[model samples]
Structures are given as structure tokens and as C-alpha cells.
Target: GHFRDNREIAEIMADVQSTLLDLREIKSNDKEIMYLSDQVQNANTLFLQCINKLNALPKPADEGTMFVGSMLDGFFGNFLGSYHRGLDAEAKQNALNVELQSAIAAVDQLEAALLLLPKVAEKYSATLSDSTGRIVVDFNESWGYSGPNDWLVLQNRGETLKDCTILVQLTGASGKVRKNVHFLETWPSNSSMWGRYQSGEEVLGRTVEKTTVTQVQELDITIYSPQFATQIQYVYQGAEKDKDIAQICKDLSFQGAYQPYESGVIWDTQRGAQITLNGVSYIPKCRVDVAFRKGEQSKGWHWNHDSWMKGETKSFNTPKGGLTFDPDRVDFEVSFPNTNYKYKSTLTVDLKSGK
Candidate 1:
């Protein structure tokens, strides 16, 4: 009877269960997939803990003593199947949350891979060397991307590699070069090819010995990671479209900056200073100036040294930028145009360096 009469506890249990189940539909706002995954696991543990506490509650003491007591006890014991379905609801909620989290992670990864596709394509360039019967195949870098549903497709216009038989050589990261042959005689439009290579697993098993070519675009090659494009351009100038791809990746992957410091030469009271701003994306053109004054002057401190204020560094940390730097008995100030950070330091005479 007492258990059946506890309306507040019953309502609280119902609310928690509802909330736990609702997590399945709510999307995670966290940007990091791994962090969100950990959060879901912890939430599941908490849900189980709450359910166990409710399940541990004792039933009415003297339920079998009276008819009304026995009936009420049965009703209380089976209230929303609380006692019968131990951990089942919580388990289902956890599974649902996990499934949702996995889906979110998969989508995020695929989007990232898609964003990098253009850059990867730019690195696939081909050109003919002056040497007779030899084609120079150059690669900016070799990269790989993987997902659940992964496959490579090569799209070519019937004219890109028409009737060109040439040896394909791939230079790996360790400078080991592997060679293969690609013969394009009357290439078809929108066809596929699979082949086996004698060296470098990166190019082998991608196409058959003889397959028709599919002309989709001027140069549309959708290759899986670890595989690269080896077609050549018939022009004279070196490829420059994807030249900044490597730098872009570095800029994107930068996590944070380190402690900023000033460096340069310090002789007696005269100091020549430069800020070697230490950061993951530090560029040489960034504007970093050291302002200092001798003794106390009304004009205040003056700009002593400034780095690439008009060059490429001006765009750094903006659409554009670290390094570590230098001084004695002087007041110093560091200024960054892109950000709202200001740094000032005082140098004593003992800190002077000749070099």
C-alpha cells in the first residue's frame, strides 16, 4: 500500500525514463565526435544508475496480510512494468543514443572527406618531359581517406588520355618509385578500368586490365584514399592550382598557439627586437613589432622593429598566420593587428645579448 501510494517517486521515475529515451532524438552540438561519443557513454551509465536505485526500493511489508493489501501490492509491483522490466528500458535508450551518435560521426567524417576532394584532385597533374618516349608524372603529396561505404571512380572526357601508352611511376614517401603501364586507345566515354601492378600497392587492383573509359568531365577522377591520379597535362607551365593545398591543411589542423615571446639583439641600453610568435600556423610575414624607449621619454615608447607589415604576413592569422624571439633595461610592447591581444614586458640591462 505504501509503495502504491508514493505518487511523487513514481512521477520522478517516469520523468527520468522519458528524458533518457528522449536523448535518442536529440542531436549532439559538440564539434568533436570522440568527445560526444564519450559523453553518450557516460550518460548511459548515469541512466542505469538511476534505474537501479528505483528498482532497489522495497515493496510493501505486509501486502499478503489483507485482500486489499495484496491487490495493491501486485499493482505497485507491476507499475508500468517497473519491476518486471529491469534494465530493459535503460538498455534500449542507450542503444538508441549510440546509434544516433554513430550516424552523426559518420556524416561529419564524410563531409570532411568531401571538402578535401577538390584539393586532392588538384595534386593529380601530368606533363611530358623533353626526353623522348618518357613522361614526367609528378605528385604534390599522397593522401588517404576512408569511410564505411568507400570506392573510387575515375571520370575522364573521351579526349584526356586518348591513344597515349605510357609508363606510370609512383614515388612513395620513402623515395621508392614503382612503375606501371596505362594504354588508352580509343577511350570510351564513362567507362571503368581495373588493373594489377607489378609494384606499389597504391595503384594495383584499382582497374581491370582493359576497361572502357567514361567521359564525364574534363578531368573527373574519384579515387579512394592511398590511390592517386597519374594523368599528365600537355602544357608547359608547372601546375599551380592546388599549390596551396598543403598549407591550407596545416592551417586547418592547427590547434592553438604557444606562449608569445620577443627575441633579437640586446646591446647595453640599445635593443633591436623582434617577436618570434610561437604558434602552429605562424607565418614569416606576420606583423610583430617591439616598442621600447630609453629611460623615460614624453614621446613614450617607439616602434623598434616590425616584421613584414606590408608583405604576406599582413594577411596571417586573418585570411593569412608563430615563432619564439628578444633585450635589456627597456619597456617593450607587442601588438597583433588581427587579434585583440596586447603583450608588454620590461627588459633589464643584465638580459642584453651580443649575438
Candidate 2:
């Protein structure tokens, strides 16, 4: 009788949605973000505690948490425990098994999808905080994974952030291969989180344009532009998992599935270092499509960076004639998964500072 009611649950749910709504609006100093963030967290905690309490309640002494056993044997014949009357426990166990397995599968399938959305947001709308002088990204534009193949997009228009470089790393969760990509192509190897420019020397003037993955353990990205420099990391997996949940809705509510099942990085490099590029290489700047596997391969996604999924398709085409940095601004977008909901805003970055 003292249990919390559905009305209370509804109130908490409203609080969550309301807080998230506020999270979408922006004020110059992230004051809205910080305040709304706390409200959202609190609402989520309250909702979860209430839900857990209800789910864990002992169903009157008769209904037992083991109610499923009774309902099961009473309806469907039990082959394993034909003589036992405790079939109730078995049914409850079966239901719980299905639920837990689904949750874990969701994590396996959607982890990459969710992880990529933030990167897409940061990649485009990343901002440089004047207070700390460090480029900052918060997990606001998260992803919803629906499948293994979908559109990914990130276009930033942050006007007040600029003057640094960019770096990116891709790796497998198995700790087997490490991949790295640098935007500046300079700034020396393994530099600190913040950049240090030489006297009167442009950070972009240094050599070494090749992007290499050190091992399968860490996949990371660092960007250095005029006054903008930051890096991001995510865990990758060697094992294949179901990817049907990464679907995103379009303009007319039509759904689209986005999968980054295959993890890698792309960049514009100097001509001399071009030979190092492999595994479905495409010169987006030059429109040159090079099939590293010579146009004959299968399951090639698993192949190491040097040799992608052997026996798989490594075919792709690029645009003609190299890509030139706009100096004013840049954008990167990721495929989105088809997920149905009222929220349909995508990320956009505008370089307001250094542009």
C-alpha cells in the first residue's frame, strides 16, 4: 500500500525528458548545460530507484518472485521437470534470462553507435573554452545504433574555437592493433594534451604525414588547428556482434540504419606519404579509388591496417585532385541509425574563432 505509484513514475519521466530538452538549448558559458545536466541526472536516479523498487518487490507471499513457475507448468507442459510442481521458478527464470540477454546484446550492438554520436558532435561543434584554454567536448550528441551499415555525419560551425591541429586514432578492443591519425601532421610525436608551437614556425609546416595505428589496444584521435587541439578515444571489439538496432529517422520519419562496424580514420596527406594509405583507400580530395586487395577479396574488414580483412572487398573510389584545407572551417559527418523518437536534431559545427 505504501509503494510508489505510476503517477510518481510519470512525474519522474517528465522531469527526465524536460531536463534533456533544456540540455539542447545553448547559452554562451555552458551555464544551461551544467544546471540541466544535474537535474537530468537526479531525475534519472530517482526514476531508476523507483523502477527497481517496484520490480524487486515480493509479490504478496503467494505471487512469489517465483510466480512464473506456476504460470508455466499450469499452461505449457514442462519436459525438464515434468514431475515437479515448482515449474513456477523455471518460468520466472526463463523470462529473466531473456531480459538479461537482450540487455547485454543491446550493449554489444549499440555501444559503437552510441559512442560515435558524441564524436560526430565534437568533431563538428567542438568549442575552445577561454577559461581553461582547452578544446572541450561533452557527450551531448550521442548515437543510437540500429545496424552494421548506416550514414554517419559531423559538421561543426563553432565560430569562437580555432587555432590548433587535429589527430585521430582507431583500434580494436582486443588490444591487438593500434591506429593513429594526425590532422596537423606535425607537432612532434606523443606531445602533451596541450600544444607547444615553435617560435615563428607554423605547426602545419613540419613533415611526417603518415597516420599509423600502434596496436589494437587504443584507438584515439587528436586535432590541432590554429587555436584548437583535442583528442577522443573509444573501445573497439574484435568479435562480431549483432548491429540491427542502429537505425535513425530522416526528414519524413523514414528510418535509416547506420553502422561503423568497421573502425578506421581518414585524412588528407602529402603526396610523398601516399603509398602508406591502404585498406579501402579513397582519395576524397583526388577522387582516386584504390583497391588494395586488387578488387578481389572478402570478409576484408578484419584484415590488419596493413592488410585488411583478407579475402574481403577493399574496393572504393575517391574524388579527383587532392583536398585543400579551407582554413576557414571544416566538417565531418557520420551515418545515423534509424531510431524513432520526437528528437530529430543533428549536430552542426562552425569555426567562429580561428576562421
Candidate 3:
């Protein structure tokens, strides 16, 4: 029974290994890949435990004599007798069989779950048109845009998006409305075609001058894709402080620090304070809000009106009036504007100002 059980377990392991190899080839996001890999590890661990128990079973005494006696019994009336030497060995073997069965069931369930994971697109392309019915904007696999038009394109890199409804607002060089609330749709794993609106026509059927595409000053785009919705927590790994500013603040006195520079003031705009934030987003078109605070006094910069791309890093500096004193903390907040998904992180600063 032990030999047969060991052989069956070996076969099950081989099957599971093949399935894991297939899983690595599937195109999915980082989160889904991690989840599937964990399931495979759990199944492999269970198989190892079952093999260890099978090998630890006691061997039968006098195997040759026992085999001969068992053969004679099999030919006679005692064919169904126990194969092991004692009741204890029989009980242990029974328990091992139960455990082996459970391991096999786990592998089966893992394979079933693998079949249910969705196949997501690896990349996408977007094409936009101007009022002249010409393709004025083209975005390729790298999400880079090329054309004579002035526009902002926000691309979703790794996240899965389906049936996306995009709202775009275009402004001319005079900061007047060239276009507003133009709706566009994007299909799954396919390129998007936009700019179906007629020239000089607004969403409310108002008429405006047909402005030149290249004279566009600002472009705002917002996307609503229910299928691409997922909660993401943007982690604040840390902040990189400016070395020059740090050295200046080290020997400065917090009291009477308001004096002008070259007149004995320690910190000022000439010796500005700045910190570059390191962040990586898995999704695109996010809004970033950064604030630097020292007690009740705080300064903030909002990027809610702009688009923050995936895997992009943003840097912040001290307000127009540079930091006269060391900041106690800095806060970073990111969210998808017009959506409920939001994430916030705070960093406590130790400026080592020697004050």
C-alpha cells in the first residue's frame, strides 16, 4: 500500500508543476500573479508533508518469509488478511492514506481556481482627432503621443480597463473653452477612437470659434471604467531631503530666523528647501495632493486638475516663502478624482536642526 501510495503522489506532483508553469505564462496584473503563485506554493507544501509521512512508516520484519506466507494464504482461504505485521502499522497506514487523499484534493481545487482567472490586456493604443476630422493625436504601446496638436493623454498601463467612458475638456491658447465634456468609449484589449464631435459644437449645442488644435493650452481628461475599478494603496516609501538645505538648517537657530539673507538670516529663498517624493502607481490618471506642515502652519500643492501617470515621480518644494524653520511632518495623498478610491501617507521629519 505504501509503494502504490508513493507512486500516486509522485504523479500528482508532476501534474501540479506543469500547471504552475502555465500560470507564469498568463498575462495579468502584479496582484493577480502574486495570488496565483501563493496558491501553488500551498499545494506544493502539502504534497511535501504527505511524502514525509509516507517515508516515515515502519518496515515489515522478515519481508521474504512474510511474502511467502502471504502468497500461500492468498492461494488458500485467508486471501483478505492484513498486509502489515501488526494492528499499529495498519492504523498508521490508514492515517497516511487519509492525509494523502487530502493533499490530492487540494491540488485539484487549485487547478480549478486557475481556470477562473481573467485574461487581461498587456497594453493599449489610443487615437484622438481634432475638429477638422484629422487624426491629430496618436498614442502607441509606450503611451507616448505624437502630433502637431497640444493635448494631454493619460494612459492606463497595467490595470485592466473595459468599456471606458472618457470625459475630455480642451482649452484654447486664450484659456477659453475649445471643447468640453466630449464623451468617448474604449473597448477591452483594443484601440480607442475619439473626437467624434463636430467642429465648433459643444456638448450643450453651443457654437464657438473653430480654434487651431496646436494653439490648445490645457487639456483635462477623466475616465470612468467600472471594470478597471480596484482599490490601490499608494505607499510612502520615504522622502529624499535636499542635502544643501539640510546642512544650512543644521547650525541655524529657530529664534530670530526671519532676518533677510546676507544680513545673518539662516534660511531663505536663495537657500531653498526641497524634497523629491518617490512613488510608483499601478494605475493611471490619478490626482496627487502634497502638503508640508509644521504644527498648525501648513503649505499644500494640489494636482487634482492634472493627470498623474503610472510609475511617475513628483517632487515638491517649500512655498514661495521658503522654510524658515524645519517642518515637523509631510503628507502625501493620492486619489482617482471623481471616484471613491483614495490613499494617504504621512512622513515624520527629523531635520536634525540642532536647535
Candidate 4:
């Protein structure tokens, strides 16, 4: 008797059922549930392997040998001793087969429950709620000389949403989809948040005409809040890129000569006082104003319809009285009519020591 008793098989069956119930109660939203599922699968495999090994074992007694023994017992008045022994072995084998079948059934049920774990986990992962009055999502894009800049704007209109996870999908005209996720500790009431969909590095001198190929046409956003989830979609309203003129104006430099005068240190325009924009990208036709201030006196020059291209240098000599005397700092203001965006930046240079 390879198996002395059915206690082990019975315990295995009960354990399988208990594991199934435990899986049913697992309300996990993360990889922990997946790990449990894998463990269950491995246990099921071991059960099958055990059943296979049991089935492969040799039968307790062969049928041919039992028939011969029965015939001899009938003739010799041995009272079927050998035949009875064979019958006992056959009964034990049959009982073992029954136990194996029951084990197989229990394992099958466990596997069926395993198949449903993922669906159940997904259901409990993020519960969706009506965001109609609670949240608002919008999309905006602007074209710039470099490329298109896509932005997702989320506004919380009602109570605060805690542990917010925002997912954004941007689809372009070329059938390319870009996705980005943002996390916020709390989105307060009556507050708005902006997330830019970074499409990667921008090429130099990217024009408006070239943006048609990869222009964002649609936007899908999902907000996962602690209480519930909200999903929304919007058609992208495209606009020309809003170039940060202030950022581009970082390269603007003023190289001029100044002399200490009784009134104030006067910028000596006769000694090659000039302003230059160096190694700049393509700038649209915009107005740029350069000013110098010294106390109450400020002198400035306005360049109308000024634009420069990549690797192009634009410099202009200061007028005889264009720059104020002993200027502490130079200010730059650029206005773009196309995007209606104004950027102001300042540059301070030590003129006395000329560093």
C-alpha cells in the first residue's frame, strides 16, 4: 500500500478550497495580488505532478495473475486465499483512484478562481465616479518657432481631491500617441493645475508650416482620486507656439563704453556702444525694446519688426544719446503679435570694471 491512509489527500483538498476563499477576499490593487496568483498557480502545478506520479505507479496486483490464482483456488479447495488477497489489492487501488480524482477536481476549481483574480483586482483598482460637477479638464496648444507646445489644464471646482494621479494621452494627426502621468498630493478646490505634454527635444528653426504633420488633434485625460476616478476627452484647439521670449533674450548682451561725467557716468556712444543678440533661433517679426536705467533717468531704443534666424547675429550701435549714463541694468522687452505673449528680461553688467 503505497498510501497508508487518505489523510494527506483529504488535507490537500481542504487546503485548496481554503486558498480559493482567501483569493476571493484579496482586495488588492497592486502587484501583491499578482504575486499571490503566481503562487497559487505554482501550487496547482505541484498538485498535478503528484497526481501524475500516483497514476504512473504499478497497479497493486495484475489481472492475469489474479485470474490464474482464482482458477487454482477453485480446484484445490484453498478457499480462494490468493484470489481474496488479489481482490483486496484491487479495492485499495480503486480507492486511491477515487481520491486522486477528487484532488484533481479541487485543483481545477482553484485554477478557475485564479483566472478571475486579475479581473477582480482591476475592478477594485480604480473605482470611477461622476466627475461632471466635480472636475474640469481642458487642453491647449501653441505653436512656436521651435515647435508646438501641448498643455493639459485641470481645474478642481468642488472639494479637494487627495492623492490625485493624472494620466494624459496626446494623439497627433500622424496617428502617434504620447502619454504622460502626473501625481499631486492634493488638488485644492477652485484651483487649477497645468501639465505640459513634453514631446521631446525641439528642432531649431521649426516653423508653423511644419507643425501640420505632428499636430496634436485629441487629448484624453484620466484623474484617479482617492475617492474615485474621472476620465475626460477633449479636441485640441491648436494655436501658434508661444515662445518664451524672456528665455530667448538670455543671450542678449550690451557692450559699450561709459565715462564718469559730473551729471552721471555717460555711455560714450562714440566709443562703439552697441547691443547684440547672439546665436539666437528664428524669432518672429516682433518688437524688441532695449533700455538702460540710471536712477531716475532711463534711455531706451525701440526696434520695430525685428527678427533673427538661427546662428544669425543682430547688433545695432547705440545712438549718440540712446543709452542713459552709468546704467545699472539693461532691460529687454519683446512683444509677439502672433501669439500675443509679452516677455520681459533684464541684464545687468558691471560697466565700471567692464567684467
Candidate 5:
């Protein structure tokens, strides 16, 4: 029974190894990858314990006596069994280690693709539109793999932006409206990891996202007309910080509005703004909020950076160019003149010429 039980245990361990190898052969999601990595760790521990027990057992007796003949036979059988078990455990442990390392590397690659690409784009392409009264953002996504087997993974160079927010307020205008909105959208959280993975593909194409993209080869969004608007107030979360991710917003506002208004609160002025996200811990679970007030008490407009969900809060920034820190919420307030005049209407970011 002892020998039979050991065989059964060995078979179970082999099954686990096979399962891990199968996972490595295909594209997998974050949860699946993490689960496999954990399983490998548990197997290693089990193997180590089995080796220790085998090493503690005494070797078989060379001479068998009439009185101790039966005892000697049993001891020799047990000793041989332990020796074989130890060898098997060691071999499996070695293989499991390799699989664990590969799984972890895969997880890191997926994280970069899902969470880092967008952040990198926001860092470099967070620009204010000069020709249109809109905030222009550009993002790129790509994937590749290394090792003997072509594993599906994303590039480590890029970063991601979760629940990121961008607020644009057209001050000194009447009846404001937001247009040309776009996002580097993602699939459902529970969706398959191989949703975008293609077999035998060495290099993934560069994917792009823009604020105001058009179906036509050429397109533009203009927000000013006879009124010729003025003053464009905008704000957004910057890139990852260089160090101390927990205090990522220390340099700016910890959920506070951005001061200096990237491009002076003037019409037709284009300026680029960036917030570093080098080390924020909760990048994937971040949320953003932006508020725009036309008149001091008008209750102008409130918007969410992404989809509206439960437990979401209202805008939190103060008007008149001020910033405060608060991790619990993102608050920024901007007061725009609602003169109700036709010529004083707020136009696009690049329509007017004067400073």
C-alpha cells in the first residue's frame, strides 16, 4: 500500500506538470497566469518535503539474520522506494521551476501591455490641440515574444492608464458642448486573454487612439464660429512618477487639479501637459473626475474620465487656478464667464490668433 500510494502521488504531480505545460503553449489571462505560477510554487514545496523524508530514512542492511530477516527485507524495500521517490521529486522540481519562471515573465509582459502602453502615450502625446478646440491624445499598443516557444505577450516598454481623466473647459462662452471623444478602450475584464492573440504572429501591429478620430483619411473638429471664443482650461493625470509610486501625485495634486493650465487659459493656444505615473501602485484600478463650471453658481457641467460606475464622486478641483491633495477623491473647479454674448462665445483651441 505504501508503494502504491507513492505511485499515485507521483502521477498526480505529473498531471500538474502537464497542465502547466499546456498553459505555457497558449496565450493566457492575468488570473490564469498568476494561478499557474502559484501552483508551481506549491508543487516545489511538496517536492522538497518528500526529498527530506527520503534522505532521513536509513539505508538497507547488508546482512539478514534469521531473527531480523523479515525486518531487514521490509527496511530494504522501504529504502529503495524512498530513493526512487527522491529522484523523481528532484526531477519534477527542476521542471516546475522553469515553468514558474516562464509564467511569471508572461504575467509581467501582459501587465505592461494592458496597463503601461497608455501611460507611456499619455506621457509623450498629452498635447493640446492648436487647430481645434479639443485636447489631442495619442496612444500606441504592440506585442512580441522571446524564448524557444513563441509566447503571446506585450512589450515591456509601454504603460497603461486606468480610469484616466482629461477635462477641458471653454471659458467665456455660451452653451458648452464636448465633442471628438475617444479612448484606448479595452475588452471586458473577464474576457479571454487570447482575444487579440494570433497564432504564428511575430510582431503585433501598432494600435493608435485619438481624442477626435474620423472615419475619413482627413478630418478636424472646429469649435469656434462668429463668436470667436477665448480661454481654454484643461487638466489630466500625468505619467508615472520616477520613485515612490505611493506618492505619485506629490509633485502635483494628489487628485487635485493641475495649475498653470498647460496652455494659458487663452483661445487658440496649444500646450502639452503631462503627469508622471512612473510608480503609482494602483494604476489598473485608478479613476478620474473632471468638473467644469460656466457661471459661479450655474452647476455648469460634471464629467467622468471613463464609464460611470457605482461609488463615483463629483468634481473636486477649485476654480481660479488652485490645487490641493486628496487621494480619496479628484476635485478641480474652473469658473468660466457665461456672458450670454454672441461674440464672446468660447471657440476651438486653435481658431483664434491673438494671445
Candidate 6:
């Protein structure tokens, strides 16, 4: 009976191993699982054979309580039966560990591949039109333009737009509507597009470089040619920290409206903006309010803080630090002209099925 009981237990362990095939299907990192699965099946077979040997023992020995194997040969003995199922169990658990480790390794490999690409464009073949009042260059719907800096993306976009003349379009007060200002010429194939943007204060024939694109809105990149409808991505140009809006405004301290942004009473600048609390913490499940204000510490927070459902805040805890882009808090929801451009706009960040 002891041997039979052990055999049943071994069979149960085998079933657990069989389920590993399904585990392997869901996760490729189940090498250990596969190994343990094979081991358990083998152990079950061995244990079954042992059970049969004990089952075949003489019945006279089984009848004896202690030692009275009568005139006939008899054997009622303690079993070295297949009672040890623990070894196989430990191996099965180890398999799960191997599976999980492999999963994490695979994710790391993918991230490495993405990180190895060219960070910025090597060169550019930009052509501006002279007929237009102001040649406003907007990279609409481009990849790598998710946010501001680090915007130069190479998408392999746009139809083969021909008959494009090359020139420089200077922006003016009328939201790029004035074609009065222009710089004539084409940037050759080997032209330095990146160097031009990063070189902050280079004298272009004494035509100072004022508009260093510190932030990128979006990228609408295209590789125009015979491969017209191919996969060309937009690479929005990025500006350095010194050129970033909040920092630039700090340096300039200029007051007034800039083109493209309708500056009002307060110049909705991001200077002195900060996040109060961040990091991994248990946020209580309740009516959470996210507020932003345009005043000192003693002053109250901005009105009408955005509220998120209790379920919404749960996922935020799983990230590395429970936050992203917390330090560089710059969102151009409203335009800041200056202290004189007093256009106060408070922006808040949170998780929602929102825009």
C-alpha cells in the first residue's frame, strides 16, 4: 500500500510537469521548466517500477504483523519505496526562475537595439520657397517628435515633392505670413544641418542665428525621391539646454509676445516650476486631486485640480520611479509673453483615457 501510494503521488507530480509545455508556449524563457518537466516524467516511471516490485512480494509476509515469516519464504519490510517527491518539486520551481530571467533578458536586448541607432541626422537637403511671405517649417506628424529635444528622427516619408527651390525663410510677427525676409540658396548634399543648429552663435555671413529650435513639436520627415511613398520618418530638430524655452526665457528676461503663441496677461513660462512629491509610494485609493498653481509656497494651489478614478492611479506605482519627465516640467498649454507677458496657465499631468 505504501508503494502504491507513492506511485500515485509520483503520477501527480508528472501531471504538473506536463503543464510546463503550456508554460513554455506563453514564455520562451522556460528552459528550466522544460528540464524539470522531463525529470519529473522520468522519476514517475522509476517510482512505478519500484511499486510493482513491492506489489509482487509474497502475501504471507504481508499477513505477519512483525516477525513470523512462517515455514514459507516471506518478506514484509519497510520500503525504500518511491516516497521522495521533493527533489523533483524543487527542480520544477527552479524552472520558473529560469523562465522569468530569460523574459527580462529579452526585453533588455530589445532596448539595446533601439538605443544603438543614430541619435541625430547626419545631414539635410532642405529647400525653402521664396514666393511665400514667410517660409514656416513645421514638422507635422513626425516620429521621434514625441516631445521637445532629441527630435532629429530618420524615417525612410512624403511623396517625391519635386520642383522645390532651396532658400532660408525668416519668421516675422504675422505667424510666418510675411515673405519680406529671405536668405537665398540651397544646402548642398554634405551640408551641416546638425552643426548649424548646435553651433548656438555662429555668424552666418553676419546673419545671427536667433531661432535655435530648442524644442520640437512633432516630426513629419520624408525621404523625397524615386522611393516616394516609402517609409520616411520625421526628425524634429532639438535644442540644447541653454536653448530650452524655460532656460532661454530666464536668460533673455524679455517681455512680450512671440510668434505662434498668443501671449496674454501672464507669460505661461515653466520657470520655477517643480513637482512636490515623486518616487515609489503607496498612493491611497481615493478621490485624488492633481493641482498646479502660479504662486509661492504659502499661496494655495491652482483651482479645479484634475481628478482621476481610483483605478486610474494603480498602474503608476509599477514604473521604475513611479514617474517620467518629472524634473523637466515643460508643457506649452498656454503662452507666456513675459512678466509683462502675464499669461498664467497651470498644467497638470496624470493618467487617464485622456488627451
The predictions' CA RMSDs to the true structure, in order, are: 24.3, 25.6, 26.0, 26.3, 26.2, 28.4
Better of 2 and 6 by lDDT: 2
TM-score of model number 4: 0.33
**Candidate structures ordered by TM-score, highest first:** 4, 3, 2, 1, 6, 5
- Residues 1-355 of candidate 4: C-alpha lDDT, one tens digit per residue: 0011113433444443454344345443445555655655565565555455555645566564321111111100111111112234766666555544444444444434444443443344458767898777665555445434444567888787654556666777779765554445457888887754333322122211121225566777777654567678766533323333444445543333332223336534331223444444566677877776767877777777656555553444455554436677667776765444575766665766642
Cα lDDT, model 6, residue 233: 26
What lDDT tens digits, residue by residue, belong to model 2 across residues 1-355? 1112123433434533442343344232464445434544553454344335434633333332332111111000010100111234555444444433332233223222222323323433445333233333221111222211111111233333332233344343344332222122123222333211111111112211112222223335555343444455533222111121121223212111111112237744221101222222221111212221111321111111333221233322223223222122111112222222222222122224321
Number of backbone-clashing residue pairs for each candidate, in the order shown: 33, 97, 0, 5, 27, 23
Judge candidate 5 at residue 119 and give its lDDT.
28
- The regions of model 6 sitting more than 4 angstroms off are 1-150, 157-199, 202-222, 226-300, 303-355
Give all TM-scores, in the order shown: 0.20, 0.22, 0.23, 0.33, 0.16, 0.18
- The per-residue C-alpha lDDT of model 4 at residue 68 equals 12
Query: Using lDDT as the measure, which candidate wins?
Result: 4
Top candidate, metric TM-score: 4
Q: Rate the local accuracy (lDDT) of all candidates.
A: 0.29, 0.27, 0.37, 0.50, 0.26, 0.25
lDDT tens readout by residue for model 1, 318-346: 11011112222344454433223334555
lDDT of 3 at 155: 33
Query: In model 6, where is the ten-residue run with the lowest total lDDT?
Result: 69-78
Model 4 spans > 4 angstroms off:
1-122, 125-130, 145-149, 201-213, 238-355
Give the lowest summed-lDDT range of ten residues in model 1: 67-76
Query: Model 3: clashing residue pairs?
Result: none
Clashes of 5: 27
lDDT of 5 by residue, 159-229 (tens): 33222212222111233331221111221222211101111211112221111111111122222211121
